[model samples]
Target: MSPRAQPRGKLANWGSSFLPGAYAGSYVNIGSMKPDAVIADLKNGSLNRSEQRKQADLLAKLNRGFLARREKDAQIEAGIEAMEMAFRMQFSVPDVFDISKESQATRDLYGDSEYAKGCLIARRLVERGVRTVQLSHSIDGYDIAWDTGHGDIKGGHARLAKACDQGIAALLKDLKTRGLLDETLVVWGGEFGRAPTSEGKNGRDHDHYGFTVWMAGGGVKPGYSYGATDMFGCSAVENRVHVHDLHATILNQMGLDHEQLTYRYSGRDYRLTDVHGKVVKDVIA
Candidate 1:
């Protein structure tokens, strides 16, 4: 998906619009959840049997009310799945987010930044059956620092790259070691790339025409590069894969037919790729 007004907004878009019903019920922000408190509550057994029964009853009532209002089976299933996820998270969140339980070497591999922690958490989530896990790199509230603008391009990019390089490499390596890499797709890229020409003396502007995005594992050929940009890196020169094509390729990897994965909204069927996209099968393993 494309970047939105804010990182959270982009996340919301992915949850609400990109895959539509598939993820509408699973949107969560780890930043807002106090995992320690959750763990404490779980350990303390604060809810008595009677209180637990009451809460369950209330949840069932709410589920019934929700199902009554929704016509689509997918919507009903989404609500049920959300409820199940909430129940599962009560146990999973504590274990998954607890990086302290990991070995010192593992921790060192991922470094010690919040962003790096997020990447580690993403791997945990995937291992625990999470369909999608987005790790955003918006340090100090800058959503797209890769924009470069009038900043020092080499220094800025290098700093950000250094911050995430070890963590990402660690994540991929860990996944491979666990035999999960074959099934887990890892995509790396920005919303757009920087321009070939300098914006100022040392910075660059946005370049939408030619940008590089890479995907690994999940049925994609390893160590393979598809498509190309011009000599100046200003435009796509060969095997151009549009955004829609990328979406389609990802869906294909997930065993989904992009055209058939539609949700009904506002009296029409909406899909992630709109009315466009062709699976770039050449990239498939």
Candidate 2:
């Protein structure tokens, strides 16, 4: 998917694109406000304590009513989940993002880029019960910068890979040390891969025909590569895994059957993998 598709403005739109109504209200941009300020505001909002209690009581009542309906109402359940998450985050988010709490050696292991910091934050979040965390390699705040199409691929890819490699390595190592790697899934890839053929002098154009993605932990076999590109690294030659398959495998790792995990919208059900996806069982442990 194009980075342009991702909204840079409000969190609602972004959440809708990825998870629809499920996370719209739970959107928290760690980049926007300091965790301390967010916690403070949540505690000392315009509403007084009694009013807040009443509101919480009302929400609980509504949630019970929604649960009694027996319909798989994603919007209702998502709203309830969002409210609960928001409340819990008031206490958890601050400490989770505080990298200063990490040892100096751990900090050095991950390097010192915003992206690297995000990787560390991801580990912390996962350790604290966040199920999913995404860390992208983008020089700018947006994801489009990873589209390396122009100028020296050697130097450009090297610089980009250096930070990503260090951070991901550190993350995997940290998770393993804490015995979380077995339960946590780590996936690394881009929207598309660069073509093997040259673009200008050293750069390469986007190649949607074939690319590579790797998975670690979460039931995947360790140190085993599943597929292959041609000798020139242009296209997949065997054991091809489509993006849908990737999604299915990830959901499978999280104990969710991708086909069954659907949300109702406009009188129809939609899922992350749509109507297609087969779990690549060969890669599983």
In terms of lDDT, the poorest run of 10 residues in model 2 is 1-10
Winner by TM-score: 1
Off by over 4 Å in 2: 1-20, 23-34, 37-77, 140-142, 260-264, 268-271
Q: What's the distance in Å from true for residue 270, model 1?
A: 3.2
Error of 1 at 100 (Å): 0.9
Candidate RMSDs in Å, in order, are 4.2, 4.4
- In order, how many clashes per candidate? 0, 0
State candidate 1's TM-score: 0.82
What lDDT does model 2 reach? Answer: 0.75
Writing each residue's lDDT as its tens digit, candidate 1 over 183-247 gives 99999887788888988688888889999999987989999999999999899989999999999
